[model samples]
Structure formats: C-alpha cells, structure tokens
Target: MAEFFNSISRRKFLLTAGASAGTVLLAGCLGNPPEDVGGNAAAPTTAQPVANISSEQAPETTAVKLGYVPIVEAAPLIIAKEKGFFAKYGMNDVELSKQASWGSARDNVEIGAAAGGIDGGQWQMPMAHLITEGVITKGNKPIPMYLLAQLITHGNGIAIADKWQGKGVDLKLSSALVSQVKADGKGGSRFKAAHTFPNVNQDFWMRYWLAAGGVDPDNDIDLLPVPSAQTVANMKTGTMDAFSTGDPWPYRIVKDKVGYMAALTADIWKNHPEEYLAIRADWVDKNPKATKAILKGIMEAQQWCDNFDNRQEMANILSQRQYFNIPVDILIDPLMGKYDMGNGRKIDDRTMAPLYWKDEKGSVSYPYKSHDLWFITESVRWGFLPQDYITNNAAKAKALIDKVNREDIWKEAATEAGIPAADIPTNTSRGVEEFFDGVKFDPEKPEEYLRSLKIKKANV
Candidate 1:
C-alpha cells in the first residue's frame, strides 16, 4: 500500500511539472523571449513551417547554436528560427545566441557551442579568412572557419554627430570639417571616429569613405574600435565625431536626434558585400548534412526576407527583446529602403534596400570568390594584412580564399532546396565593381587596382 502511494505521488509530481513547463512555453510563444542576460537566449519555439524538406534530406542533427550581433544583416538567421524555416529543414532545435558585439561573436566561434559559445552565424568581410589565418583570434589561434553565404548586401552606413551639421560632414568631407580637424590637432586633439571591429567591414567602410574624401584615415583622425551602444552614447555626449556601423543603430541616431547618416554603404558602393553566414570548419566537417540543412533553411529565409510584402512582419520579429531590442518603427523604413537622412536629404528607393537573395547585379546570396578576393585585396591596401598577401602573392591569397569560401556547398544546398538553375550563378567572379569615388576594383588584376588607389598604405 505504501509503495502504491509513492507511485501515485510521483505521477502527480510529473503531471504538475509538465503542466508548469507547458505554461512557460506558451508564455514564450505569446511574448518576447526572456531577456538574454547571460549572452544567450532560449531557442525560439514558435515554429510554423515555411518550407517542405523531405524526410530523405533530413539533417544528421537537428540542433546547432549560432551567434549574431543585433543588426539588420542578421535578419535571415533570426527569421529562419522564428518563421520555422529551420524547423522545416530539420533544424528544429537551432539556437540563435545573441552576441554582445563582433568581438564576442569571434570569441564565441573560436570556443564553439560545446564550451558555452556559438558554432558560427553572421560575420564581417574577411573575418572568416582572418580567423582561419589566426590573425584576429584570441592568442592568434587559427580557428578554421567556412564562409557559407553572404547574408545581406548594403544595409550599413556612417553616421555623424549632430554637432557636425552644416560643418560639412557628408559622403565627402568638406574643407570646413578638414580645417577644423587640422586646427583641433594643434590643441592635441583630433576628430574621433569609431567602428565596431578593426580591419573588418565596418572599419573598411569608414576608412574607404574617409580616404575617398581625401582624408587620410590613419593619419588625419583618431579611429578606434568601439561597441555600437558605446559609440551611440559617445555621439550623444558630442565626444564622437563619426561612427561606421550597421543599421538600427544608425537609424536610431537620427530617431533620437543625436546624429544623421553621412552616407549609406549603398551610396558609397552600390550592392557592396556586407556581413555573411559562416560556420566552424570542424562543425561542418562533422555534420555535412546538417550544415547543408542550415544553409537551405537560411536560403529560404533570405528569399522570404527580400519580399517587400513580408518586411512589416519581419520588423516585428526582429524587434523582439531577445533579438535587436529595438522598436519596429525604426526597422520598417530602412527595410523598405526609405530614409529620412535627418539632414533634410531623404531617399526612397527599393533598389537601395538591404537585399538578401537577389538584386539588380545578381544573386546576393551567392558567396562569390571574387568578393572574397576584393576584401583580401582591400586588406592589403590598408596594410591590415601584409602587402604580399595579395599584391605580390596573388596565388597565395586566392588559395586561402578557395579554402575558406564554400560556394560549392551553397550551390549544392540551393539545388537541394529546389532553386532553379537560372538563379544559380555560373561564374565565381562578379566582375569589376565601381565605387562612388569612381575607383574600380577588378578581381582579375588586384595589383593594378591597388596601384590606382592614391590613399592606400600598400606600396604596390
């Protein structure tokens, strides 16, 4: 009789516990996820199935962890989880870990998911290559990483503090601003600018824009790496002159009356390569099928994100506290390619929006090797990587790009996802790209491209 009583109590305990767990899950589905205080959040449990991957193509594993900074480029990853693309592709247990910053994302990728870090997610240009080469990793440990796909193109910009208004700070630096910078230098001060990470996409954008305006990035001003939130704060206090960062923050600057955008990356270089989706090399090798499944999920998500009709709902999902922690209003205008400029100059063009799957040039999702070459070549120009890294040793740089960029995997995943052959790119190169400054970069002859740049640090 006592044994029977104990069994009954155990059954009651489980029943009660199960009921409590259900309530919590329902709450999670009904509202924003619990605040991500510990650098990670619970897997989004609201799966509604956006695709139909067959059982035969089911992934080897249904679980993976990815890290992302709160920016527009991370939309595909977040949308895939929320809208059930991951679940449809048998990645039902995918976790979208919220990284505090790009540095945190890099560190998390190095440690991987097993050690309370991420397997990989979104990254800036050449970061995967640099990480693979041990140039940026902690202790210079070479962490092999694979560049899977470009997440989005042209959703970033440089913002200037409101104090610089009419002081001639725009896409091109005015002589007025230049003279002020020079005068400030005499007082042992310099115009201060910041990017989230050094020698990466944001840094390169800021530098390129400054250089194009005849402002030497390395010598004329004080450029430093700072987190997005801190940069915004500094802008408010009038201590920061300029900041190069992704959207939401830049838009927030205008919305909060702190600053105005100097130039959209789209204006600087139309259809430029932005952030990307990459994964740990070890994780991809161990679970090749799963890797492809994740890619298929992201591909579907990218297509969905590009649809203008879906952007309103996309803004809602991205604004959740667990993701960007921003208002939906700030995101919708940018997603629709409408900008107020905050300085009496407004732009409203769909072609200028952040593109995911396809754009005027071609497949925005395809990770072209040529794009990788351009990043490496730019690194050479800025002296971030050794000069011979690309100028004198083209073959060596190409070999590294070939090793890190996995466009073949993207093709295989696209095919398996039933994407049409017409949509798949035939060539690895995107051809010559022209900048707003009229400078062109040809992947075929990076040496000549480097030679044409008058403001570059590379001797070649």
Candidate 2:
C-alpha cells in the first residue's frame, strides 16, 4: 500500500502541474487571476446558482488547503472540482492536498488550521474527544466544529484475505465466518483487523458488526489501528487478516482477487452517516459567512456527485494519479453500485453508493443523536473511555457533543443554500433511520441498547 501510495504521489505531482496549466488557461479566459483559482476568497452573503457564479465572486481562500484521501466515497470533493461546483459557488481558489494517511490529514488540519478537513466517515465521537481533550486543539478553548455536509453513507466494506477462502466466510452467504472466529480459542484465530483510527465510523461499525454476530470485538480478535490507505496491503502481507475501511481499498482487494468483502459496513448499518466535513470550532465562529459560503460550495459538489450522470466523471477524476491513483475500473464498481466480490457474490444495490444530498429532502433530514450516543457507548465498551468516565464526566462529554451543532449548522447552511429546511431530519434521537437488515436506531436510549447486548463489557 505504501509503495502504491508513493507511486500515486508522484503521479499526482505531475497531474497537479498539468491540471494547473489548464486552470491557468481557464482562469485567463474567465478574466480571473490564477491565484484566485484555488484558495481562500471573500465570502458571499446571499446564495447563488452554481452555474452562473463567476471567479470574481470566489472566496479569498484560493490557496485553500483542503485535505482528503483517494477513496471512492470521497466523490463529492472530486465531483465539486470536476463539475466546477466550487467555481460556481465562488470557491475558485480551492486546492486539494492528498494526505498520506487519515491521521496526516487530521493533523494537517489541526496544525495548518486550514478551511476544513474531510473525515473518512462520521467521526463524531473522536472529534468530540479531540474537542474535550484538546489533543488537536485547545480543550478548554473547544474548537467549534461544523458538519458542512455529509459526503455519502454506506460505501464502506469489510474485506478478509483470500487465505480465508472456502472457509464459508462470505458476508452475503452467511455469518458463519464470524462464528468460526468466535469458535477459535483465545484471541479467536488471532485475526487482526485494521481501521484508520479508533474513533472513526469504520471502528464503530467494525465493533458493532462483531458484537451483532455475538462476538466481542475487544476480546474475540486483535484490533490493530492502521491508516485506511494501508489496509489492503497489510492484509496481503499477512500483517492483518481482515480490515474494515472505505471504498477503493476493499474494492481493490476484490479486484486483486486476494480478499473477499466479508460484509459491507453499510450492511451493518445501512444509510449510516459515513464521512463529514469538519472544521475547527473556532474557525466557524470567527468566519460564519465564509463558513457558510464554503458549505454552499460543498453542498453544490454533493448535489453534482449524487447525479447518476456524474458517476463516470467522478470515477475518472479519482482515478487520476493526482487523486486516488487506483485504476478507474477498481474505483468505479463501488461508486456505481456494482459490486463483484471475489467469492462469486455480486451486488447491484444503489444502496452501496451512498450520496450526500440525493434526496435533498430525506438525505439531510435530521442529525441522529443516537449516532453520537452509539459512538460514546462503543468507546465505553472498548475501554477507550472508562465506564465512570461517561457517567462522572457526563456533563463534559455532553458539552463536547453539544459543541458539534449539526442541527443548527446544517439547517442554517442548507437554508442559505436553498435547501428546504423541512427536509432536515427533525428527530435528533434517532441515529440512523435504517440498518443493513432494516433495523432502526433510537439514539435516545443508547445505554439501554448497550446493556441489552450479550457482548462482554469491561467492568468500570
């Protein structure tokens, strides 16, 4: 994976140069300077149609340093640029920087303090921790974060190496593989699974999937923390046996025929909130207008990506060396809702390609409070936080969670962007409306849900 990334990096450098030349020509024709083509620009007060906007209206942040990785799920960011959504919204100066790892992206956002950073999935729990603990920014100061918007949901999957083939481990075929792991003695076949971070969405789904299958993730297997970009190679080299990560990685494994997608994380929790556009709390507080403008640009990008016609274009951009660096064939399957699992399982469900604002009304409905509670429960279940910590520090934790005003921020931005406010989800306690098997989540009672589970819980 590292080698692949290195090759991708070089390819992106060349592509960036080439793309820059084209941007220059386009800028000249538009009577806009090249410098305003990519970074921070002045914010706009009123909404504007993406198609009619000009570079002169572009925000001053052109050299805007936005961080992202090369995953199929991150199509909105790619589409926004490819389809000129950002340019339409006056984000003409936006520049994308492909970070080496998720950690790198998060760290860069913290240190560089750019406009915002993209998360592989809804990492509300970890982001909450970051705010309270001051690990990334000052804790007491509390970096106010905003959910610019959701990229897509249900695009992530879990892949197990080919060695596990014929072991009847197919996710669609059965949950027998999970049972086998449970039957394995202490450490459960010593299976190793990698995730980008402990607090991200993959971690939540990975742990929940195991527990749902009657396996205690913390005890049944060894969970290794690895960057999402390295998951595939780690599995190939035997450093790990399975991994739950976002698109292109798992899809790449299937393409290589070296691994089989054991389960789609979306299957574990369909329509699950995947990635989010998170910015420093302070940044939002200080640049409310600018923040809204950025959100407008991102919202436009999300709309462009949700259009079926744009899938091919999105895949093409991500396949370029400057972005995902993977073959377009590998990237397109998951993005287009066509799945070819190496184990002879094929899926054509549109559910696979979760979009940001597809429904406009349904997609951006409500911020599921249950989603946040689920992560908190998982943190406790996994010992990332002490049992008493949640209870004793309930006030602090709640304050941290409250700092992420998804409802207010999303509503305001969506309204400003001409997205109907009625479309926003009104029930904050319901985390996700649907799970893989059609289970609904009620975030209001996360503790009860956790206590009902048979999985092992550390005595705290």
Candidate 3:
C-alpha cells in the first residue's frame, strides 16, 4: 500500500473545508479537450501497441482539460492527444489547453478542484512538491497535488548574448566567465542572468550552474525573472547578460545569430527530471481508472518520444502555432541534440537531448522519490519552501516524498501498458547523483545537502 496516502489520504490533503465546498459544487465543469483531439486514431505515430484489452485501460473520467505553456517539453502530453493515444484508451475528450505562463498553469490547477476547468498539466516538479507542503497554497489552504510522471528531461539550457559569446563563456569546459564577471564587477559592471520562474527546474539549474563556477548566483549575479518565451527578446534587447530556460528559447537565440548556448542543462545532470504532470489529488482520487489511462497513454507517448526515428518529426510538429509557435528549423538542432554553441564550436551528439525513455543512465520518465527529495532540498536551499518543509527533518521529507512520488501508479500503468519491469525503477533512487560541478546530491542526506549550499535565501 502507498504509505503516504495511507497516512494522510486525499481528502485531508485537498479538502480542508475551504477548498472542498467550492470544488464539490463545480465538479461537473469539464466539457472537452483541445481542438487537436481529433484526426486519425490509428495514425501509428511511433509507439507500438502496448496493451491488450484489460480493466486497467478502462477510463472513469472521459473528459479533462490539462493546462500547458508553450514549449517542446510538453511533447509527450501533446503527442498523447494528437496521435490519438488518449482517444484510443477511452479518454476521447482530452484537451491540451494552453495556459499564459508557468504561474498561470499552477494557479489553474490549484483552483482546478473548485473551478473544475483544468484537471492537470505539465508543471514544475518542485512547485508541485511545495503545494503538497502547503507552501504554494490557495485561499490559505494546501492544494493537494500528485505528479503522475515526468514529461521531459534536459530540453533546456543556459545561454549568453553576443556581448559574452566569443569572450569565452562556455560552462562545460574551463572558461573565462568567472574571470570576466570578476573583472566586470571591478570595472563597475554588474552581470545579470535570468531564468523562467523561481523555485522550479530552470531556477535551480541556472543557480547551480553559476554557483558551480565559483560565482554566488544570488549575490554575484543580478538574477532576473525572464519568462521562457520572452528570454530571447530580452537577451536581444540587452535586458540580461544571459538566461537559463527551456527549448526553442535557447535554440531561437542561436538561430537569430545573436547568442550561443553556454551549457545545456542536461550536461549539468543527464536524465534529470524537468517538468511533471501535476494533477489535482481530488481529480486523481475521483478518477482512478481515468488517471491510469492518462498515465498509460503518456507512458506510451514517452516511449514514442524516446524513439530515435520520431524526434525530427516530433520537433517539427511542436513548432506549430498551436504548440511552441517557434519555427521548425530552429527547433531541429536542440530537439535532435545537434547542438551548436555559436562560439566557433559545434557538437553532433545525442547525450544532451531531452531524452524520454531509457538511456545508459536509465528511464527518464520514472517518478522516483529520490528526485522528489532532491527537489525539496533545492527548494529549501533557494527559499522556495520553508527550511522546515517538514517538521521531523528527513523523516517528514520522506513522508512528503512518499505522499507525492506516485511511482506505484507509474509502475502499474507501465505494466498495464505492456512495458517491461526493467523500465520501472525498483528503488526510489537513481543512486547518488553527481552534478556537473562534482557536488553530490545523496538523497539520504537531504538536510546536509541544504546546508552545503553556498548561495541561499534568508529564511532557509
């Protein structure tokens, strides 16, 4: 049995009187999915048939409006909708609706239970963890959330403008970035860097990148909150020195011939889980069969996304205005892992691509509890959540992790979808992971990891 759910239950997590009454009243709000829910049901996109008729594939809730922000990271969920995977598995009424921003996506889901407009979406993993801890609340009440699975990994980057491009700012290799920043500081220049949002994947990775190079992210660099879509424009206008953000943005800069990728976040940590499908716990509780169906379809889409042959076409499909809205040409290099750093250097390698399925490290989609603990640890380090995110330290952290990991649901859905047991992680961890700067994040010593950080907020 899932111990976290056993201890708290879904009702206690979401329905604490305030959020409950409104959600109960708006329970019948879902109408349909997005406009792309139609088309060939048997189009044979990439993933082969994984399930034979089984009770596990049966969906309870037929319609759901999952929110999204335009980025290629939303690929798996989009593919599940476009390729008819959702329809094939009985969720014929799935819509991949667009949200205005990351914060918007969060609010949409937090109020989803009461408003009943949005059921789930590809969201930041750490933010979901924060919601569970009651840090990211609605009406001062904890909004219960469940991360069913990870959407994409490493489809993001850190990039710099023309000002620092040829000045040698490459992060992966030894560069003069630190020296340049120090010189600039002495010369009365303040270096600024931006990322998508605070307390999320991009923020953590960007800070980790800057800190690794002996620069205090908070104290040394003037950090800016540049949205992913506007990152390139801001960089072009010299709004910030550089940025850490999702795909197409990084690639868009290089395509515009004004900037270059400093480092792909994947190079920081391969197979790192980025965004996750944060579903309201109330939605998951009410739609058990439907939830599994959604997971199976997404798992299959993930498998399809991991397929080597499908990547090129997938990138092209993601470029449509309905999705990422970037041109197909710019997305190809990033999506295909054909990186051009724009510093007279080019890399034609697959390691940096935002892989979906199993690579040498292991499956990228597994919702490992270890990943959760690491996210929580980072969230605390950055003041995104309270230092005492849990009252009992590691024990409380583990309990919160157990509450939201949902690997059991992932394994069950994967198995029902005819996926191999090997793909499903038996252990909660991917072992002790080492970042690009050689800092080891051992999930067991989360509190110790928090203490080891050089740059952190006042509260933590």
Return the top candidate by TM-score. 1
Worst 10 residues of 3 by lDDT: 15-24
Local lDDT at 460 for model 3 = 32
Candidate 1 residue runs with Cα over 4 Å from true position:
1-47, 50-52, 186-188
Q: Write the per-residue lDDT of candidate 1 for residues 1-460, one digit (tens) a residue.
A: 2233223222321111000111011111324455333232333345476546677777889888887777899999988877778878888788877775666677778899999888998988988998898877665678999999999989998999999898789978888777777677667679998887777888899999998887788888888766677666788888998988888788888988999999999999999999999999999998888999999889989999999998887887777665665667788899999998888889999989999999889999999999999999988888777776675548889999999999999999999989999999999999999999999988998998888988988887
Taking the tens digit of each residue's C-alpha lDDT, what string does model 3 give over 1-460? Answer: 1233223322232211101111111111122323233221112234323334556457877788887666767888877776657766777677776666665565677677347557777887676776666655544357778888888878888888878755656775344667667666665578888777665777888888887777777766687666565666777788778888777778778888878888888788877888888788888888888888888888878888888788766765665545655556676777777988877768787877877766668878888888888887776676555566633566777778788777888888788777887777888787788887777888877766666766666343
RMSD of 2: 8.3
- The candidates, ranked best first by TM-score, are 1, 3, 2
Off by over 4 Å in 2: 1-63, 114-125, 128-132, 135-144, 172-189, 359-361, 364-367, 388-397, 427-440, 456-460
> Per-prediction RMSD in angstroms?
11.5, 8.3, 7.9
Residue pairs with clashing backbones, model 3:
33-94, 33-95, 34-95
lDDT of 1 at 58: 74
Candidate 3 residue 102 Cα shift, in angstroms, is: 0.7
User: How are the candidates ranked when ordered by lDDT, highest leading?
Assistant: 1, 3, 2
Q: Write the per-residue lDDT of candidate 2 for residues 93-142, one digit (tens) a residue.
A: 55666655554454445555333443122232355345434443322334
